[model samples]
Target: MASTLYKWAGLLFLSSFPYIFTLRGDFVFDDTEAIVKNKDVSSESWTDCFYNDFWGTNIKSNLSHKSYRPFTILTFRLNYIMNNRQLSALSFKTTNLFCHILSTVLVWFTYKIVVNIQHLKKHKIDISYFGALLFAVHPIHIEAISGIVGRADLLCGTTFFLAFICYDKAINSQKHSSLFMVVTIILSAVSMLFKENGVTVLGFCLFYDMIHNIKNKKETQIYKFCNKINMKRITILMLSIVFLLYGRWAIMGGTKPEFKATDNPAAFADSFTKVVTHSYIHFLNSLLFVWPQWLCYDWSMGCVPLIQKFLDHRILCPLLMYLYGIFIIRAIFCKQNKKFTKRILLLSVALIILPFLPAANIFYPVGFVIAERVLYIPSAGYCLMISFGLNKIITRFNKYKLGLIAYIILLLIYGLRSWQRSYDWQSEYQLFVNGMLVCPLNAKIHYNIAKVSDARNKTDVALASYKEAIRLYPEYYQAMNNLANLLKNQKKYQDAEYYLRSALKYKQDYPAVWMNLGIVLASTKRLKESEQAYKIALQYRKNYPDCYYNIGNLYLEMKKSENALDNWLKAINFNRKHELAWTNMIALLDNTEQLDRALQLIPNALSELPNSPLINFAVGNIYGKMDRFEEAEKHFLKAISLFDRKVQAIHYANLGVLYHRWKRYDMAEIMYKNALKINPDFKTAIRNLISLQKYKNR
Candidate 1:
């Protein structure tokens, strides 16, 4: 009992030790779309978490991810709820780490089940310990552990193992077999709910059942497989597969159209060429299991060289295919009655190949060439191969400590590498910096690095990164739009406008490019052209408050008072905290002598924006107009006291107007002089001071 307990504790500790630094990690990659801005996790309606895709409850166009992984999203929602309805990075990240830990424990149990099979009892090397340990610390899984969005893979793997373990017990059970069967069914659904790849559990169950029957019957060939198939078990597994596929088709509208050339990779290939290239790419991804180094977050097109020619560096493709067939044949035959033959090989192959099917992009492209997170499920199989391979050596030569030394060194290397790589998830900047070094041709990594640089106000560095991204992938319109924004900030309006137009030329479907073009055109004082661009932006993106706000400003400048008021109202409706719209509405009301209505709206604006300096200052101006000097002073002083309010000479001059109306000529004169001191050429301060001098003289 104590030994079993110690093993469990030891496995959990080994799994968790390398990932301890993840508690300090920041959200990166798809973390922004999935957790940061996802309203489904933030809102109260839990049904929104299920019915809609990851993008949102109301997906207009499928430009963004529309994956229906409700259970995975539910976990993130639960984390947000626990963190007081705020998206706490630590809380979200800890939940991801928790799943990794749970999967580690499950891996130990699953490997134990593999070893304890009736045909494989003699090879008692405790692969359960080392298999789980290797899987726990594999550096390739850093993408899954460090990034919050990678939880889908973790959840899918956990439930897949749990289903297998439950099924194993069910078959061996006399009492309550039906209950276990029902639980396994429920787990099958739960696994698929976390990720579309969860359908692979069906393959796992079918293979396990087949291999079990084959071991008892002593059969050896793929064609002569499952000669005595249990109709009941096969029927049940088939029904599970059918149900998952039907549910997926019903929920998500079959396959989506690729939004970019890179999205449809097969289009870049000519029929059989793509299949062979894709096969070679798959081989490379699996090879990482043996020697997991130069691990990348993305391996989009340019990042990895494709196998266009038949005689390329990936020449081992034909050999790998041959060896794969041989492994299955050898496993089925069990010619040597080796413990690793029948069950282990079957289980390992199922683990590697089943989860890989959905993401293989053989039927259709999955929008990217490669992503490491997709390998999380398959890595379990790799770990099994490694654990037993090490076990065979330990059994062969106990006297020579060569295998033991290799095992120790392997563990140290994997463990230390995982620990060091966990910090790459500390921030997007770190991940991009590290990833670019590993994959310099990955356009997405360069683009992300540019965004981080721009956020930090390192414009020169950001410009270089953005240019580098475009150099790598010329059709990156998103990077072009951002590059234009940087040029706009530098007041190179013509250059900015040129890039914005070029962005539209590449991808006219993007609404943000139109909006940016509107802004850049307006900066050049082309009001008609700017208005046309804004209208186009609205046509593409209906809920754009910024576009509405800018349009309102343009209308006001064009003397279209009613149009300005209507647009500002729309902007405020969309985003109540939009200070520009609220301030403009108050000014329009004040100009039209609708002071009472303007006064009522001030409280509403304040409720949304409690610290809005413009709102407070405008309230002061209104109260002073109403001859309420005390209330006027209170609000005006509040606005002035805020250091972030960007106080100017006009603010002090406005204060002078307030004091001048209150007939405090002495105080008013001081205020006017202070305004003039800040802006020596201010006509308003000069006129106010001269008028106050006459009152003081009296």
Candidate 2:
């Protein structure tokens, strides 16, 4: 009983591991859209926060049209309800830590329950213990456990383990409790709600039951009994659950479509090939988790492909891996093997590895195909296999003390690695920077670090990083476009144009890049070329609202009111929140003798960008155009207050005009003088003040 209690204590520690360490880290990777900017999760409505409505309608439409496990969403909603959704980093991190601990505990209990079901009692299954310990300290799991918003992985993993544990108990118990079955099914459903990946547990369950009965067919006659049980009912229940989970995806339509690469249909073929290639790639990820010498959050780990075979060539890593799998299978199934030990080892390996393959979606390669969060459930299986293997090895040694010492060293190493890995995930910048050390050849890593550097105002560093990313992967269209935009911001119009052209070479139909290129061309005084670029972007994606707004801005620069109005109206129609388009549309309407309509549009524009500096400046200019001097003065002052010195001069000059129009000569002179004070080379202020002096003399 004392030894049993010790085992229980160890299980509790593993379960509570997440709560033991807390780090308040900034958002990283997908957390930005999933948590920070997610309107539904951040909203007060319980229904909106918890349900999939936000996913299908808002995020899926614009960004990713894929189903995520909904259990995570519910966790976010719970956090919101518990804390009023207002959280500092510490509070948010604490919630993640709590969930992680809960999942860890669930993992420990799930293993204990499974072993108990087998009734192969060995007090010194230290191999299993260390496997569980290794799982607790696996560096790769930090991304899922340490990050605050990764509560989704924790909640989903926890529920998945719970459901598995209950299912094992229900299947193995002599009395076969219906309550356990009901609870397991309910928990599985909850896991599905948290994340799409959680549905994978059911696959494991089906496979485990089938395998367990097969192995026990003669010895326990379990096969005959299980066959008598309504296997069809179980299969139907499982099918119903799967359909209920993913049926909406089929009804709603397929996943979000990606733009064809280089306008080539052949790229589709390449993408399909990438799916098979990715299986080999994904297999490498599991190998790392097993050995875990170097771990990275970014999935774009580099390995050169073999060129000899078009279809049947096995890459070295995957080839060796396949051989190892074959060896393991043969060892488990050989006629000379001990039946119980073989069953245990095979089951452990299968549980750890099989369920993960579906998520890898090996037939379709995606960007960052391997992620740590994907391993949350798989880790349990890995730990059990490792623990059982260690025990087998220790039995050969005979000297228990030496074997125990070896186990301790292994656990310590894993613990230390895990602790170090946790620090890397403390924030986005740190995670990207550290991940780069392990995955330096990954273009996405370099690109991610460049985004952070840009945010930190390290423009030169950002430029170099972007350049390096493009150098490594010339087909990296997003990096090329971003580098061009960065150059455009620095007034390197010629260089910007070159980079933009390079982006177009690979992704010719990218609407955003085309819009950006157009904006840069117009700035460089290439009006015809700018117009051509804008027209091309609109041709590709007719509903692209930003492109329409950008083209409208170009027309406005050329003083083409009719052309500007047409584009701005199109922009507003595409996105109701296109505030700049609305503002520009109102200005164009006022010029076209539609004062009432223009006036009516002001509130709508104000509603979107309320108190925004640029919006206030635009509003002030509109008031000036309408000859509402007092209103113009009010808005101009507001704009000036929001502006930094460089932009404030424009507001001051506009205010001087408002004063002059109102016949406030002294005020006009003062305002003009103030504008000149702010900017020494204030051309408009200088001319306005001279005119005011002449007026006074007359």
Candidate 3:
């Protein structure tokens, strides 16, 4: 027990040492979806925590990513809470580190229990320790452990390991107790909340127990003990699997559409040959365990070629892995004499294969052809294979010194590589730049870099990357859409129109593409085509608020006041927190002298978006117009208190208007000057100050 503790302590330190560089890491890629932009993770109320989908609010059309991972998302919410409701990469990365450490420790604990239960011999070599070390330094797991968004894999892995350990305890415990069994059942169910891959924990446990049952005779106490409880265990395991299937199927409805072709290789495989090709490539990628180097963040489309021949060179290694897996299966269920070596091999394969079953596109699309993070749980098998298989060969020659030296050298190389990779993960820009070097032809990497550049207002870099993305994959509608948006922002309406048309040529059904096309058309004064485009967007997607909002602007420009108000109100109904819709609707209400209705809507809008100073400011102006001085004063003060930028000069200017109405000309003058002080170039403040001078002269 003391030695086990010492080993785990050392392994924990070893596993975490290289990741210290990631302490300063920024959230990248899916972190944008999973944490930074996921409103559920940043919500103050627990109702939002439980009720919201994985992507947070469903205001935007994200059917492709309709996920129910409340448990995993809660972890992200906890990090948000710790960071004071602000999205901080440090807080998320810290939680990831914590999960990694816990998982590493659990790996050691679970491996020991499995070996002990299997009645495997404990010699000078502890296979479990070696397995744990190999797992720790395996560079394939870098994406899962180092990337903050990959916490789904980490949380799933941690829960799966605990469930496995609990299963072993339940089956092997001398006292007849279903307590451990019940815990195993609950843990298995809980694991799925973290990730869908987690459901395989039941299979891993049941299969391991089945193999152990084969090894132990009926007369043995171990076999007899389990025989009595095994039926109960099986029942519980079956129930868990049933619940998982029902939840995913019933809750999510059915298979999600692939919004992007690269989301799932198998799903995107429009032909049988394509499916076989992608399947083989996926298997070969995982076979990287045998040669654990040349790790990549993203593999370009067509990088993995089709397996045309029966015995193709590209798929040879993958074929061998399949044959070995067969051998391991044969060894486990062979009725005659079962070898301990074969049992270990089978168990190792179980560790690797079971967790990956969910990602087998045969089940459904899992939103990636191959991601290194999904290999985190499966990499445990690689560790076990090395410990049990390679360790035996080394000990046979009694070359402990040689094996030790080789192990140290290999870990040093891997550790250094991992350290270098950690730096790539330390910044969002660095990851994309590194991804660019590793897979320059990867359209998604370039697209992601372009998005980050657009966010930072680096228009040239964004344009270049977006163009490169389009160059690599001409059918990339997202790149086309984004590039058009950039061009639209620059008032390159012709270029914007061309790109939006190109995007429509590829993905005509995509409402956002149509919406952008409408805006570009409107900017170019093609009012008829613009209206058609907006109507087409609304026709394709009924709940499109952006289309409604844009059409409102078009109507307002055409002096169709009633139509404009109707469209803006529809936009607000679709997305109550939409600032433009709120602004437009309240403006129309104020213009029509429906001040009471505007005041009533402010509370509902406030409820939807508590922190929106614009809503408060708008309400304040309405109250001032209604002659409710106290209420107007309160809201104006609230808006001013929340102001964090010189761009908020309008709020102070509104205060000037309020004070002027209240017959405090001197106070109004002070407010106008303060507004001018904040933003010297603010024309509204300049006009307000001119009005103040007129009042003073009078």
lDDT of 2 by residue, 444-563 (tens): 788889899999998998899999888877888899998998999999999998999999998888988899999998998888889999999999999999999999889988888778
If scored against the real structure, what TM-score would every candidate get?
Answer: 0.89, 0.79, 0.79
Please write out the lDDT profile of model 3 over residues 525-585, one tens digit for every residue.
8888988999999999999888899999888777887888889889889987788788777
The number of clashing residue pairs in each candidate reads 0, 14, 0
Query: Using lDDT as the measure, which candidate wins?
Result: 1
**Of the candidates numbered 1 and 2, which has the greater lDDT value?**
1
Q: Provide the lDDT at 681 for model 1.
A: 90
**Better model by lDDT, 1 or 3?**
1
- TM for candidate 1 is 0.89
Per-residue lDDT tens digits for candidate 1, residues 450-486, read 9999999989999999999989888888999999999
Estimate the lDDT of model 2.
Answer: 0.71
The candidate maximizing TM-score is: 1
RMSD of each: 3.8, 5.4, 5.4
